[model samples]
Target: MKSNDKLAIHELLNKAAYGYDSRNVDMLVDCFAEGAVMSMSITDGDLIGPFEGQNEIMKLMTGAMEGQMDTRLHNISNIFFEKEADEAATVLSSLTLTAVENGSIRLLTTGIYRDEVVKVGGSWKISKRHLDLELPF
Candidate 1:
């Protein structure tokens, strides 16, 4: 991969992590393509499904955050990227989430996010993302 291509992919993935960690849904959605697909499984509460399109993805992600009254943090690590072309790439990132809920702070979840990224209209966006949940709660 070219240096610029690598850097661009890194930036895209970093933005995605930061956006999600901060619960910034708008920015999070900005990382995705219009017809992107996202799937997330939750071990607690009511979050488990495959959401298609940017709108649905936003609703589900933002909705999950709405239930939290305390702060939460999603830490992403082990990011790996491979460029398919100047306009496309694949990214894999592992995440560990911790949140304070009902007066207790505990690990809320852990998972791997496998994402397909594409440059559309000169902007990087996620074409698809599959979240593999690993934590029991």
Candidate 2:
């Protein structure tokens, strides 16, 4: 991959984390493609979803946001490309989730995010994502 493409992918991943951290609906919405899908597995348990389509994915995200009482920080790290091409890539990264409540902070979970991203209209957008969490957050 070109250096610029790598950087853009990194930025795209970080943007998604920042969107969730700040609860910015528009930012979150912008990170996904129209037909994006998301799924998760917690503690090696059964698959929680393959929430197909951007709307379903957003519904899952918004519902989680509503249920939270603390400020969340989703730290993305160890990003690497497993495969890449001009229009699409498979990426992997680590997630460290923390929550702050009542002036105290604690680790909620750590996870591995496997994402498939594609260039759409000159920007990288997540087309599919599957998160494997070490614990329920």
Candidate 3:
């Protein structure tokens, strides 16, 4: 893959993580394509969703921003590009989540994400993302 392509993908990942942690729905939504699908499964909180399209994703994110939790932060690292092409790429990233639940601060989750990102409108956007949790909150 080209250097710029790699860097662009990294930037996309960074923006997604930072935006989610910051609770900026617009920023977070901008990282996805119109028909994107994000399926989330977490052992804690009994949450499993196969959110389809940007609207559904935004709805899910809005809940996260307004949830009863005191605070939540999502950090991404150890990104690896499994496949890269002019139109699409498959990437895997390690995830670390910290949050305050029931008024006590705690490590929420540790996991990885399998993402399908595509170049749409000349920018990289997530077409699909599936998060796998290693531990619960």
Candidate 4:
């Protein structure tokens, strides 16, 4: 891989992690494409749905994170990127999330993110992302 490609991948991953941790809905939306998909498992059930556009993605994230007095730290590891073309790639990464709530910091979740990314306007954006989480039952 060329140095520039490595840099692009790193930037993309960092942006994603930062966006989520900061709870910046707009930033998160910018990381994905129009009609992008994001799904994850929750205690209630699987929150599986497609976010058709950036506006919808913003609404989903804002509503989901609302009223949670929690600050999250995203530790992204084992990122493997497969080049699908000059403008696209498939990436897989493991994530460990730590959160602080009620003055206690703890490991909140662990998950894997399978993502399809495309370069849009010279920046990598996620076209699809599936999050599979592991929880103790």
For 63-88, candidate 2 gives per-residue lDDT tens digits of 99999999999999999999999999
lDDT of 3 by residue, 1-137 (tens): 77788789889988998888878788899999999998867653455778999999888878767764567777889999998888899999998888866778778779889999999988999999988887754
Please rank every candidate by lDDT, starting with the best.
2, 3, 1, 4
Model 2 clash count equals 0
Q: How much is the lDDT of residue 112 in candidate 3?
A: 84
Q: Estimate TM-scores for all models.
A: 0.81, 0.98, 0.86, 0.84
**Compared with the true structure, what per-residue lDDT tens digits does model 4 show for residues 71-103?**
878888888876567777888889888888889
Tens-place lDDT digits, model 1, residues 20-134: 6688887898888899988766553455667889899888778877877777777877878744677788888888878876788888779888889888887778898887777
Residue 134 CA displacement from its true place in model 4, Å: 0.8
Q: Deviation in angstroms for 65 in model 2?
A: 0.4
Q: Output the number of the lDDT-best candidate.
A: 2
Candidate 1 local Cα displacement, residue 35, angstroms: 0.9
TM-score of 4: 0.84
lDDT of each: 0.79, 0.96, 0.85, 0.76
How many Å off is the CA of 22 in candidate 1? 2.5
Better model by TM-score, 2 or 4? 2
What stretches of model 4 exceed 4 Å from their correct place? 42-47
